[model samples]
Target: MDTSDVAETLDHLVADATDHHYSPYTRFDWVDELDEQQWWMTPDLLSVAGTRHARELDEKQLMRLSKWEAVNFFSLNIHGIRELLIEVTRRIHTPGFELPSEFFHRFLGEENGHMWFFAQFCLRYGDKIYPDKSLPVTTTEEDTDVAHFLVFARILVFEELVDHFNLRMGRDATLHPLIREVNQVHHDDEWRHIIMGRKLVGLLYEPLRERGDQDLRDRLDLYLRRYITASVQSLYNPSVYRDAGIAEPFAFREELLKDPARTAYHETFFKRITGFLSSQEIISGSPFEGSRV
Candidate 1:
């Protein structure tokens, strides 16, 4: 968290970003349509996976659900990228952000490209992108450093969660080739983002930690834990279920969210991010530990 150390990391990240940049428009060969018969997402990554609910669906119905889940996943990326872009934009070139602003330019461009491709996939294949339904994180912290720390912490958590899906789906051969390609591309970009976010979040929190603001830390931890929970919950959209032709969409969603198997999946999925937050002393433990919905 030294000033020189932060500057050096940003320098290397900025260089990497510059050397690896690509045009999103020409990056992939778009087919007229994605095959409806193939899995758009890995079966194990689906919302209903690991539960009795998955047993009720026939293969064709499960494939249909996968398609909607894939769409929902891309839509979530679009919305998440937009939120992080806004937060980063507010900080770039501003006071206290001088060190990371150069990399922020690269971050902004890459994220915008990401939003474009994710939207393209959702629109061309699914006919519509799902709307963002999760509420924004609201905080009572009046300290500038606290506010800044929260912004980067939220960004880090978001990227880590998205990368969980990206890393798995990108390598999953059961998914369609285009699905794999998109995920692979995203996974590649997200590594840089995640690394940068972690470094920045740690640096941002250092000042607060030095002040021994245990009360403030506790409050921030609660806010971020709820944010993580809300983020995961957004995937269980009733609209997604309805679009998949599932009966009693709301009731089905409610049941699935409370399922023990689903809770286990959530814990496994969230392990890395929660561990990282705990390492930073940002949170005492995993939010999904013994958590329901």
Candidate 2:
């Protein structure tokens, strides 16, 4: 993981960011209400999609679930953006991060706009934004290199997970125009972040690998795998199910989460990040194996 390998890519990303800048505030036309009959999210991307639980729902229930799930999706974005912002801000001008600091400025600004829009969508349409339930990842004080790698690796993992939804919903014609536009805007910006984050995470992980600190590496691997699982589990929010008028929301959540169809869907969607991590030797093998509930 030579640092020089990413300098040119970072410079190009900065140029692209500068050239394609937009004010997220005025980018879309908001309405007093979104059509209830319209799909807020693509049906295939729903948490319970491909499960027997989804089949039990009528059209109205499915649409209702879509609305709440879309809100949950945006809420996840708001929280994820906040965490990434804090992590990137901590490293922007710090030691060992000189090369990508320029792009960090653009990344922060774009992500702030992203947070605002996501919050706005959730509050205006759903009448509330769900609270973040993600557990914090704490680092030991002795291993600054490990801490640094985890910061960017978590960012990469997060962006990769969210981008799957963004890219799909962005192009999905079945969804409302507002939903599509919002997703497209996020998808456009996140592509750059994902690329930059992947390179930066790899660069940050090199020092730990070179030091041959097997214990630290093992710790990082286990934490990241758990983080990945937790990230996916957040999608099956019981609150979303209850808000959608589903009975026995908690049980529904548990059932859907452990559904084999949902598990396969998770693996399919998670392939990119998992493959990248394995290829980089950041983890030993497929993190999802025996990791899900």
Candidate 3:
């Protein structure tokens, strides 16, 4: 990667951003078509779907959990997109983002639209947004290279994490049509963001990689692995379990994490992102690698 390469990448991204222009206002049909008795997400996609716990659940209770799980998923999307909006917004015209300002504006607009739709789903269906239980962690490394890498990495990984669910639920016939549509729209929007994010991170990291600063590299990798783990853990909101009528929500979540089946399922969410990052040599080993989580 050279200086010209970075410019060429940014130029392409700007062109793509302009070509795929969209308006937040007309993106989704905002009418309330939710049925009270419908499964919000596919049953097989639930965290407890394959476990004995799901077996023990009656149809009514299972649907109850599905509704809450759907709400929880959308709520998490709201939070993640909000954070990304904040990250990109602050950098819109700042020193680090000037050259990419045009694309960043587009990125910010898309994120704002995503937040609106996601929050809209939670509000119309679940009646409120779920409180974010996922604690955000930041790297201690103070270098500009690490900070630049961290911001893009966070955005890219969050997209990867949630898009796994989006891609699955979007195509799943068992979920409500409205829910599936939402997922489909979100997955479609994130495809562009993911492309831009990956390129920026790869370009920004070239200097660090060239320097071969092992300690800084290790620090960044460790932060990413932890962030990956946290992203997976965010899905297991105890409040969601409680609202879904699961007893002792915290204890249940603890036990659920220990379930080999659930762990394996969670691992699937990271497979693509980890594979991409590793192939780029951005990371050596992923947090979701066997026995790592």
Model 1 stretches with alpha carbons more than 4 Å out: none
* Candidate 3 C-alpha error for residue 266, in Å: 1.6
Name the candidate, 2 or 3, with the larger lDDT value: 2
- Which candidate order results from sorting by TM-score in descending order? 1, 2, 3
- What are the clash counts of all predictions, listed in order? 0, 0, 0
What does candidate 2's lDDT look like per residue over 150-244, in tens digits? Answer: 88888898899889989999999888888999999999999999999898888878878898889878888888888888888888899999999
Cα lDDT of model 3 by residue, 1-293, tens digit: 34576567767776776887677667767766576577887787676866788899898888888888899988988888888888788778888666677778778877888888888889988898998877888666578767877888988999988888899999998877778889998888788788778778887788888897898788778888888888878877899899988999999888777677776777687888898888887778868656423
Residue clash pairs of candidate 1 = none
Which lDDT value does model 2 have at 38?
Answer: 74
Off by over 4 Å in 2: none
Task: Please give the range of 10 consecutive residues that has the lowest summed lDDT in model 1.
Answer: 133-142
CA lDDT of each candidate?
0.89, 0.88, 0.81
Q: Return the TM-score for each candidate structure.
A: 0.97, 0.97, 0.91
lDDT of 2 at 28: 86
